[model samples]
Target: MPYSRRAAVYDVEYTEERDVGFILGLVGQAAPSVLEVPCGAGRLSLRIAPYAGRLTVVDLEPEMVARTVAALEREGHGGRIRGRVADMRELRLEERFDLALIPREALQLLPPEEGRQALAAAAAHVAPGGRLAVDLATFLPVPGGAPDPDYYDPARTDGVWATDWIRTLSDGSQLVRQSAQHHDGMSIRFDLQYRVLQGGRVAEDWAAGMRLHRYSRGWIDDARPDGMAVEAVHGDYDGSDFTGDSPRLIALYRRGPAAGR
Candidate 1:
């Protein structure tokens, strides 16, 4: 139930689909087999399926897996992909993939140790000479960030999309508040509160505490799995080289000859 309960609300809340172009560029036109771990609601999976000869999507929450499966079926990709529930840390599959992706900075949601295991698990299924990629966020709070609590800042403004992240979900509820509870050097915990309105009246209230771990290029290099050589590392979705001041860490790797040794 980590993320399933929020499945429907989550599907509609975050409308933006991300990293498609950069990811697709890596997939190329080879029509190679691809694997996506924790495929969030199939938003990205649908686009990748056409380029993949065989697409396999997996998620830890059954609700997310179901939503992904339903989406693939709706989009006519059911025959090529199946979304299954499996923890990224413990996931074990016999097949190796031409490209394996961990999108949405998912590893951030896990503790450091678990995050490392997740990377290893994904690497284990990558075909030798194939590729592995992960996108993560480790931003330093915008220098002198929003002065007001109600201010919702845009992550990046390409002019195409810009909105406060907490604007209520139109389908049912609004995230009324998000407060930080605790933080160490490694992770931060948050208390999220929401209210669902019915006919302008309060219908339901939702609240939960969540934690997110942090990562950087060095963090990834230290935990790098065997045979996976760094191909490229970007600071943002625009594919710029990563630097110390970069807002995000997106790493791409290729499994070389030493794989599986």
Candidate 2:
């Protein structure tokens, strides 16, 4: 229910996102193959298409897969991309990639146990000596990760605070997205709503929800399969050194020979 309904208007709601510079840099000028887990409307996939010799995008939503493949085709990269509607936890592709990334804090969206399994499933497809990059939202509306006062209003326990994004579409309709979240001791749960306005009146309404669990900073170290080790960790997308003051915990893991097929 989270992304299934949102896929209808996801592009209009999140079109301004331009945070792929670091991800592109990591992919470099070219890569033999690239695997994108949950290719949310192809935002990052479109950016990485040129550098990828071959791209395999997997997502749990069929609508998302269709949108991503359609975007790539529009960009003339359809022949080089494969879109699969599959759950990351049960994904067992026959092929491996030079780079496999679970971007935009997506891994955290799963329950802790499923998150680990999903990660392991991804790691299983990582070519020997290949790279696995995961972007983590370690510090959010929490105390340890430098919480933003404006973003988190502890006044509401049922729902701490809501962040809204409003955008105008080409057809003159205004789309408003409100994402409200709260920490439920174990995970941060989110409730999302989308409102479409036309002629100064609400025309349509849609809703979705998902959870992002808080993982220990070192959880990846333990969750990663054998023969994989942390190669690098960056604070943010700018490739800055990770620090306590950093707002994000982006990590890169390398799979070695011991990591079997």
Candidate 3:
């Protein structure tokens, strides 16, 4: 989960334009205190901070945290936003927040057990009756039951070429590869290989395996900690109802009255 190098070009690959509005709308008009876990490059944090009474963001990668802080400073929110480096599974924040978020499938990067633990840690930081929102990619099998071929294209910026592909293993796990080449002959590539575990052994391979988990409502239900109740599920940022064919799964949970008070 080291995002040091990826942090350089993350925003280029993943833009916030599509999600920012929906997320902000979900924050409501209450000016609630906020906590963001795995706030890589501050894509959402920077925008959300303005709407929050207070904002605290944490990421495991120091480089990402630094980038987030720098971005906030550039936007004149340095004093308003707090950025820190911390592990989600072992989070130890002293205070709770009215809203806690683990957006962009950040929790999916961890293995199953650790993912559950991370959810619990996030739940612990949510004040009673507060809400925790988590976004996950829908767990749908690739169409046609075959891996897609690699795609090559020129990067948005001049003088760069990029290629991307996925390999689906027989057991349903995936291996994804993204590579970029500069006109000057400099190149960098990364692979996210995932293997399905059955009885603690590799069952198969799948795409974007390292960063994405094939998540479902049952998965979240299984990971729910004590005193937490699933409140809503959305198919996308628009607050649409979740369905089997939805591309993303957004779950909202409320902390029980007696929990995390």
RMSD of each: 5.5, 3.3, 12.7
Residue-by-residue lDDT tens digits, candidate 3, 192-213: 4334455556655443313334
lDDT by residue (tens digit), candidate 2, 1-261: 455777867677555343488888878834579999988888899999998899999999999999999999999999999999899999989999989989876888787788889888998888888888888765444444334222334445666445566788779899887767777887767787778899989998877777777766667677776668888888766787777656667888888877542
Across 61-123, the per-residue lDDT of candidate 1 in tens digits comes to 788888888877888878888666899999899888989999866788887778889999999
Give the Cα-based TM-score of candidate 1 against the true structure: 0.83
Listed in order, each prediction's TM-score against the native is: 0.83, 0.88, 0.72
Ranked candidates (lDDT, high to low): 2, 1, 3
Report the poorest 10 consecutive residues by lDDT, candidate 1. Answer: 147-156
Worst 10 residues of 2 by lDDT: 145-154
Q: Which has the greatest lDDT?
A: 2
Model 2 stretches with alpha carbons more than 4 Å out: 15-18, 141-163
lDDT of 1 at 203: 74
User: Rank order by TM-score, top first?
Assistant: 2, 1, 3
